[model samples]
Target chain A: MRAGEIAGRPVVTLDTAEDIAEVKDVVFSHDHGYLVGFTLNKRGWLSGPMKETLDWSGVRALGPDAVMVASGDALAARDAESGATGDAEDVVGGRVITDSGRELGVVTDLVVEVDEQARVVGYEIGGATVEEGPGGDRRYIPLPETFAVSSSALIVPASVTGFIRDDLSGFGSAVDEFRAQLEQTS
Target chain B: MTRFAEAEHTPVYSKASADEIGRVIRYVVTASEHTVAALQVGGRKSKALLADWAHVVGFGPDAVVIDDEEHLRHPDSDYEQRVTAGELDLRGRRVLTDTGYEIGALVDVEFDESTGELTALETDRTSVNGDGLVAIGPYAVIVRQDAVRPEEEPPAS
Candidate 1:
């Protein structure tokens, strides 16, 4: 569990355990450094939120590799049928964390709503971007648009063709669509 | 937009009030910094003049942040997306990195949805020194010089 070494592992129940899928990842609250849910790799292929979720209190132990959860039949997580946050984030940093090896960046800024809720909407990957420019200045990038590339470059979604559109820019159309999509959801 | 303009964003929030909406005090996080300082359901990041920011940014310091209210969807929907996932290539004006190691992870990113400017990148863990912050490698710093296509999100298992 040095770092970024558990991205593809599966969390399975032991022969003696009846419930508790082997933890695939640990999804933390994007804002606070608290454990949120456990992704049971076995259940991630499910359709929707039907995936099980271990309440924040289900965690039993924290280590470099896996966060030990209370073994039980009801330990299913909301996204167990889906996937979730990893242990690397909990053992070392908080959510919205990216670990390739030992590189760590504490989230200092968050782009949220202009309303009272001000809920987190995106992150400013400045910790590592600071060295990507002249004099090593940090460059802002979005998470949905970013992806780890061999732990070196944090590529944005724009760089990846077919993922979205080429001319799409700004929050106008996408924002409207994003909002519209949410309206159609819950 | 300053150095990290993406982090400093501008979103069109509903002209709604949280005064009696039964609010849930949440946190103000950037694109990558999922685990930020704490949770405060004020109007803006500037907790000092929260009263003023409450009016412009939110309804009050207690409004609820329902996805329907803010139109947030999948995965931290409330969190702002300075950039889109399809546009990671630094073709149109993009900031460049130094080390060119491409081994570190992209903890998070910032975007200005208003003008589509990506300004900040939060790394998982970095060593920011006189030469600037680089990905924390076991022995040295990890640098990213070029853009790489994001691989398909593999199955969790």
Candidate 2:
């Protein structure tokens, strides 16, 4: 699933079935390669931001309808003391370049492997490297088993260029093949 | 049960003197307890006056009766100060669930006349049972997710 789609989904509590808050933004840890947590806002229009944040561990289920939690107590004050910093938007628009010095594209969105443990498995890119048209066509590039990511650029192995897929439907296998190739080369 | 709208603007009287003191204006709520902490009394030519719910003798149909005019005082605590400043009044505030769904705007509140305990929170679209209330913040009133239901749906099991 695209991480952006989860942005506006309501955070519902399983125990009381209350829609306590709405997802304001998805927080992703590029260093850890997984969802970190979410910044929240009050549900109604014009409602102000919430002080507490919902950590990824507190999420019971990331369903199509809502982000489920055990109860309102699942939300906790953001720990500024822990240096917790991750806003998924920081990665979007960053240049996607290979370690071999090939500039592929600019990141458009994150492809999340949705499950009990949802994680970022690939990135959707759109730029001159993907196509030749006026609006460069978008493509999905699998992430290597290990890679370096920063707010400015993502450095993947050159082998990733060959595994880029046109869409997300069969992107899973491409990721698997790309990982296998990297393991074999190492 | 008495709707806040029905209580508002009603004349307030002192049981000890049987003299009219002021009119009930707004309720100062203790959000955490889901109870009315105090009543903002006005309509007299003086500073903003408040009577704690504990001092209220009765919420009569035609008037509100208090123990004495002495119970009325100036807003003191930070919470009461906020309430007196029109920042913490529940009426017209948006109602939201903990999950962040917008239920509706709180139009009125129903409470037990004798105990000052809230009975229900009424919005244009639905009525939430008082027990589901979580917090009444400056931005919105937060309730349990299951507590919000479509006007037509049966209460959740």
Predicted model with the maximum TM-score: 2
Candidate 2 chain B lDDT trough over 10 residues, lowest sum:
B148-157
Off by over 4 Å in 1: A1-25, A30-33, A43-50, A77-129, A132-186, B1-157
Give lDDT: candidate 1, residue B31.
18
Q: Write the per-residue lDDT of candidate 2 for residues B17-119, one digit (tens) a residue.
A: 9999989988987766778888999976567899999999989899999999988889998778877888767888877665545667899999998998988
All candidates: DockQ: 0.01, 0.04
Model 2 error, position A47 (Å): 16
Residue A72, model 1: Cα distance from true site in angstroms = 3.8
Fnat for each predicted structure, in order: 0.00, 0.00
iRMS of each prediction:
16.8, 7.3
TM-score of 1: 0.22
Second chain only: TM-score per model?
0.23, 0.90
Using Cα atoms with residue i matched to residue i, what is each candidate's TM-score against the true structure? 0.22, 0.64
**Any idea what lDDT model 2 has?**
0.80
Report the CAPRI category for model 2: incorrect
Instruction: Tell me the alpha-carbon RMSD of every candidate.
Output: 25.0, 7.4
